[model samples]
Target chain A: MLYIALKMLMADRAKYTGLLLGIAFTAFLVTFAAAYFSGFMTRGFALIAENGAADVWVMDAAVESVEQTINMPDSALDRIRGVEGVRYAVPLALGTVDARFPNGRFQTFQVIGVDDATLAGAPVLKDGGVPTVLRAPDAAIIDDGGTSGKLLTPVLKTDQWPHDGAHLEAAIRELAVGDELLANDQRIKVVGRSETLPRFPPRPLIYTTFANAARILPQERHLLTFVLATAEPGLSPNDLAQRIHARTGLRARASEDFKTDTVRWYLVNSEDVGDMAAMLILAMSVGFGVTGVLLYIFTYENLKQYAVLNAMGATPRVLLSMIFAQTGICALTGTGLGLGACVLVGEITAKAGYPFRMMWFTPLLGTVGVLIVSLTAAAISARPVLKLQPAVVFAGR
Target chain B: MSTDANHEIAVRCQGVTKTYGTGVAQVAALRGIDLDVRQGELLMLVGPSGCGKTTLISIIAAILDKDGGQCKVLGHDLEQMSQNDRVRFRGKSIGFVFQVFNLLPSLTALENVAIPLLLNGVPRGRAEERVRSALDSVGLGERMNAYPAQLSGGQQQRVAIARALVHNPKLIVCDEPTSNLDHKTGQDMMDILRGVAQSPDRALIIVTHDPRILGFADRIAYMDDGRITDIIAGKHRGQLQ
Candidate 1:
């Protein structure tokens, strides 16, 4: 009977294809929305999220999230280092500087200064090397997602530039090793290219040693933005943060707690995050509506066959199982196709410099949405079958 | 009085009554129907449109409930059985052939014929074997893999009959089994049905208005205004015709 059900469903090629397309389109929309939202949320706290080695972060008492933090005095790192249960503490300086390219193009760049001795906060270099090259005078490492939002070598756009002088976001080049640029009127040379976590509304990221950052950045009383710390082996990060807070009188948080705080702040204050979440809900609602209605129409069109089966002595349970099997095939296939397409698109967008972070949980969440669509469709489609009278088969031949 | 021939009765109905709708819209489809179908019998029910011929057969098949009556098929009271048991009994012991040759259009003739056996929980391999033999019995052996739309009207009807008989049900009920066929095709369908109706332990009932196939019935019951007005032996009726 299940085979019969499948045969009956497959007999009408147009309807079956229409049903599959309906499910696939819905799944794709849901997956795209979820992946985009996941990407946006992850980028909201890129600095905190990317530095997985740090167990705790100490900043000014008023700082709520990484993006909204105020600069703290450089002495805060030394005080945090002296706290009990602290393994090591390093000063991190993050500031925006006006960078003047050799072509005289001026763009704002976010300059991050990690500890000169440890270089603990620098991103991993694309060439599988450390940022030790930043140890050289007036040298810095820029992320691959810099300047042109791509890793192209720095060059003036002319007859020789790729894409017919049209700068493609994909073809734009980051500042490469030995490329000189002016920051805050100080000349600096790119020493290496590193791959860093992406940021929304992407800006060029440049890393330098603490002493160099102070030179490239405008002078100020407080030069450090955050104090990255590691907890002792036996102490939990939360406990160590509490100890740091009690001793230094500055706000402190575990890495995970800070990440959560960042995301929470965005959720509360950023309309973009709220709008993206609402868009996700809208996509799911549309998916449910379209898939459910299409499935219902498909079932309604085949009601006569169901009546024939019922008149042939199939129990309601048997008929329901057949319907479920049909729905399962559609749901599983659509989910696989939609998710596969999402992954492929994620790859394309990531390569093209679009913020598209697809964690494992995003697709898992999309699958749950698809399942809801399937169950809703099955439940809605089953009503007509349940109410069908087998005697309808005897009507008008 | 009807002659029993000392054979066991497959279907017995007494004072069966059925009504459609409710209130002023209510129309009584059956006032009272009392009939007995015996084993080894091929009974033809002939009647005018809306005369309750189909209603009576549907009730006998346990697909519809009667307002008041005692209807027993193969010694089990249909009214006393629960819905699940009725479904089980129908799956295990009864078969139905529809006028439209209600073979699932997507399935080949072989797969269509295997539906009843599958519904009854027969393993797929055995079910396919039985389906092949059933289609072969109806002279459709070469067209086993042909879809319904690919087959002619007569061939489709034959597939329907094979489906009806594949589970070896003790009773088979057909509604307008040959109404869609042309003169020769109708007769051919009747011939095939008559061949399968010879099983001594099973019975067949065909509800139809087509008079050309009357000779194939072992007994004919004429219905008018929801009552059986006549019962005649097939041999005697053939002589009169």
Candidate 2:
């Protein structure tokens, strides 16, 4: 019976091929979009997680976004450092600054600054020398995650931001190492680029000494934005966070919570490239819908032969089982091919400096979606098939 | 069991009525048919259009349900059986040949023949052997792999016959098996059917319109307006003309 089922499916090779291709194309786009969206968000906010050295993070209150630069005084960092089970405290500043390059092209980047001599105490994103950037007063390191190459293109302020709608393509041409950038006329040279540093599209990234960062965006008198505290061994991380929140009037969060906060921040408050993402998602969904419909048409055409089988004393259940089994096999095979396509395309697209990435979890989701949609398409054709009366062949009327 | 098996009737139907739909659209396809096909007899049903020969044959074959009275093929009563049970009974004990040669287009000749046996839960290999022997019996040994479209009309019809007899069913009901063939081919088909339809243990009931088929039947039944109006007297075999 299974052989008969397979034979019936294979008889219409052209139709089955078309169905497989349609399903594969739909699955590829949906999974790829989901993966890129996930990968983009993860790469964008990696710095906050790296810098938070505490068993938990304690912020002032109601801070929805990490890039918003909520402030606390030096008294808070000092207070957390003195709390029991706390090993060390590092004061950090995250601010936006206009970077002027030697080529007179300027761009903007988020400047992350931490007061740590070894740079291990700072989230370096694996910059070449932690000691150099950590100690350099006028020197800062850059992350190459979004940069085209090893050279870090410094983005200086072209004109006053928040008022000037200056586009990036014209402002910055080529960012390379050793290029000098000016922030409020304070000159600094670009150091080596780090590999996994936090960045967004158009390279919203820069690194500088805490004192150097204070020059462009001055810190309020006796104010600290985030305190990075290391936990001593043998101390429960959650317990330490509780003790810190109890001692200092601030919210303490664990590492997972800290990551969640940053993700929540960008998701809710930030001006995301929303239209592009929405359009991509819609395209993916429409592609899947079209594939499903086309597959339904193809499977319906294929079942014309099976009607003859049923009329020959093949059971109706036999017909159904055969069609669904074909759907399952085609769905699984097509999804495998689609996943392969996504991986190959993702690599090429990523190298071409696009935001596409390959994530296995999202592709699994895509496989499930494809299977359901394909089978549903196959199921839609059952009406005409079951209605194929044996008498139809003889009477032809 | 042996004594009864030797003398038992293969097909019997009494006061069977097949009506289609209701109200103004109502039609009695087979008004009321009383028929009995003895074991091993090759019976041919002949009639013109609207004569209900096919409908009567269908009821006797257990393919269509009768609106009134009873039909029994082999041993089981049609009215008392479940739908699936009826189908299974037909697959196991009876076989049918249509004028259209309704073999699945996707299957090879051998596979087409094996379908009945396979439906009976006979494994493929054994089914294939039976199918092959049946095909050989119909002289289609060289064309096992060929599809119905690939075969000539005569060849396809033989494949249909082979399929019908592959299970060695006790009752073989063929509707117009020779109507689609040329005279010689039709005669050849009857010869093969007569060879297999012989024996006191099996019966063949065929519904056909060709006068040339009268020579091949042990008994001939005539239908008109869904009623079995006349049956050629057994003593006047060739003299009925």
Cα lDDT of model 1 by residue, A1-397, tens digit = 7777777778888888888777777777787777777777777788887778899999999988877768987788889999999999888998888886654556778889999999988877888887788899998898744235433344554412244443333323556677777899998888888778877546778889989999999888888899999998999999999999999999999998998898888889888788878877887888778888888888888888888888777889988998888888878887788788888888898788666778777788778888887878888889889888787888652
For residues B106-125, what per-residue lDDT tens digits would candidate 1 score against the true structure?
Answer: 88998888888888889999
Provide the TM-score for each candidate, comma-separated: 0.84, 0.82
lDDT of 2 by residue, B25-135 (tens): 998888768777778677778888877877777677665667897777787788898756665676777777888887777789988788888877899988888888888
Model 2 error, position B86 (Å): 2.4
Candidate 1 regions with alpha-carbon error over 4 angstroms? A49-53, A71-75, A95-113, A116-195, A204-223, A232-239, B1-7, B236-241
Give the range of the ten consecutive residues with the poorest summed lDDT in model 2 chain B.
B232-241
What is the alpha-carbon lDDT of model 2 when measured against the actual structure? 0.71
